[model samples]
Structure formats: structure tokens, C-alpha cells
Target: MPDKPRLERQAMCDRLAMEFQNDWIVNLGVGMPTLCSNYIDDSKEIIFHSENGVIGYGPLSQEGHEDQHLVNAGGQNVTQMPGWPLFTMQIHSL
Candidate 1:
């Protein structure tokens, strides 16, 4: 059996976060994309958008403090930024 080497998830996220501009709006997907929030440069005012109607949310919530009402597209609890509005979509059919 042979062991395979893999890049640390956080390290990969830190690297990917560097590719965006300071004021860019990023739509992060599930899994690895979620990790990018924790590594983005603090100096940069990057806005994170989730498909689950979350806008301007910060990194993932800590254990035991997860909000059941607040979750990402991946169904993971997320923390919202101050003054950010949560949008919900309604579908109308004829």
C-alpha cells in the first residue's frame, strides 16, 4: 500500500482566496469553497454569497452555536454579517 500526499484544505483555500480582488463579491459553493471564508484577507472587504439566501455571511459557525434558522446551500450553519439582509425567492406559476 502507498500513501498519497494531499494539500491541506485550509492551505488550498488560503491560496484560492488570494486570487480575488479586495472588493470582489464571491459566490462560494459547498465543501472546499466554504473554507475560503476563513482564509480571506481581513484587509480585503470580500462579500460572500450563498445560494441559500445568505448574503454577506461570515465563516462557518462554531460548534454548539449553530443557528438552526441560518444555513448555507449545503445545509451547514453560517454566521451573517451586520446589516446584511436575507433574501427569499418566491415562485409564481400560471
Candidate 2:
């Protein structure tokens, strides 16, 4: 059988992002999942949630323009969209 062509990073990310619908809250995992935010349609009102407590964020920060306060689970700085909220999770000792 002929070897199948593989999707490039951005194309793969775009394909994964297409699964989300408008007004849905999406939790982005570490690494490549973060890239999905950039592929979402502008018309959709998808909310990006980071495990570190950022909610309703935009996309990954461009080079040299990172915000010191916003970050995802993987420590990559991300962009803040309108109505972004911050929160903290407390772990209760068992």
C-alpha cells in the first residue's frame, strides 16, 4: 500500500478545532491542544478554558508579546478575550 500523507500541525489543529460548536466551553489540554484555539471560527462564541484557571481566553501569545499573567496548563502564555475570568482551585487534603 502507498504511504498515506499526514496532516501538518496547523491543519491537524484546524481539524480538531472544528469539533467545537458555538457557545460551548472547551478545555484545552497541554501542548498541541492549545493550538486549536487559533483555528476556531471567529463567528463562533467558543470559550477556551485553561487548567491553570484562565477562562474565556483567546489564542497563544505571539513571539515577544506574551502577557506575564496569562498561561495555560503547559505554561505557554495565551491571549485574553472579552469577559475573561480568573479563578483558583483549592485542593483539599484527604
lDDT, candidates in the order shown: 0.81, 0.86
lDDT of 2 by residue, 1-94 (tens): 9999998887899899998998999999888898888886988999998787788988889999999888887788888888887677799999
Q: List the residue pairs that clash in candidate 1.
A: none
TM-score of each: 0.77, 0.83
Model 1: residues with Cα > 4 Å off, grouped in runs: 1-5, 88-94
Error of 1 at 89 (Å): 6.0
lDDT digits (tens) for residues 21-40 of candidate 1: 88788998888888777765
Cα RMSD of all models vs. native, in order, equals 3.5, 3.5
Clashes of each: 0, 0
- Candidate 1: deviation at residue 57, Å? 0.5
